[model samples]
Target: MSVEVTDQDAALAYYVDVLGCELRTDVEVFPGGRWVEVVPPGSTVGIALVTRESGIPVALRLGTSDADEAHARLTSAGTAPHQAVIREAYAPPMFAFDDPDGNALVYLEDAPG
Candidate 1:
């Protein structure tokens, strides 16, 4: 997955420190641009932090084994979600939150099919 962030350094810190992601790569791809990638533990997916204006808000759909546990963890880590956990019709329990850059993201209890 890819996300457009204003500052790569800050994004790296947030994803690594706050979100508990492992820094996979941090290299300069161009003169002033960088190619930073981070991946969560026990997961193969990588999130690329791109430093460019895409003019669109990022909305990442993530999954956890338990919504309540994940919510508690994130909350204790100082990430106040936009909404508390809720069960929608025909959907798994989920909650929405924003990154330091105000990029919207959701964490659902069930994994994707």
Candidate 2:
């Protein structure tokens, strides 16, 4: 997933420091532009932080082993989740939160497989 940010360095810090994601890639693609990617530990999916003049922020659903724990951690870190975890029968337990750049993201409890 790609997220647009006004500042790549700050975005990288948030993803790495706040979210606990590891830096996967950071290289200048062209003058005044960079291609930065970060991924959750042990996850293959990577989130790219891009800078552009126009683009809508992304809403991403991420899988977590425990929604409640993840929510607590993020809350304590000052990410302010949007609401309490939803435990509806029709959906997995989940909660939404926004990144520093206002990119919406959801964390859903992963079902046993």
Candidate 3:
């Protein structure tokens, strides 16, 4: 359950610099150049920076807890324009969160009913 940011140095810098995530490892899977995984200090797991570069970063993860509660909390907050709860029928239940740079990321909880 992680986002594949990008392999570019600048993209890596943003996550490591601004987000304060540590440089974990370099994974090479051929033809796709090099990939890196970064984790924040004191954090357990990490998200990845894949070779597929993009201006709009997106990641979707399932089987996480608290997603349904998060959706309820978000709906009550009359702040930013947000996407409604979306369930992919046969897939899991998920909702998207947009970063400051307009990158949309999805955090999922349980499978669809």
Best by TM-score: 2
Candidate 2 steric clashes = 0
| Candidate 3 local lDDT, 14-110, one digit each (tens) | 9889999899866453444464668888996667676444322345443456676777765567424256665654335667776567655666675
lDDT of 1 by residue, 1-113 (tens): 57889888899999999999999988764456566889988898878787665322246868798999999999999999977897855457988888889878878687656
lDDT of 1 at 90: 41
TM-score of 1: 0.46
Whole-model alpha-carbon lDDT for candidate 1: 0.79
For every model shown, what is its TM-score relative to the native structure? 0.46, 0.50, 0.41
Candidate lDDT (C-alpha), each: 0.79, 0.83, 0.61
Candidate 2: lDDT of 26?
90
Candidates sorted by TM-score, descending order?
2, 1, 3
* Model 2 lDDT at residue 101: 95
TM-score winner between 1 and 2, please give it. 2
Worst 10 residues of 1 by lDDT: 50-59
- Write one digit per residue (lDDT tens) for candidate 2, span 1-113: 67889888999999999999999989764466576889987898889898774332355869999999999999999999989998966457988899999878889799878
Error of 1 at 31 (Å): 48
Stretches > 4 Å off in candidate 2: 1-58
lDDT (C-alpha) at residue 23 in model 1: 98
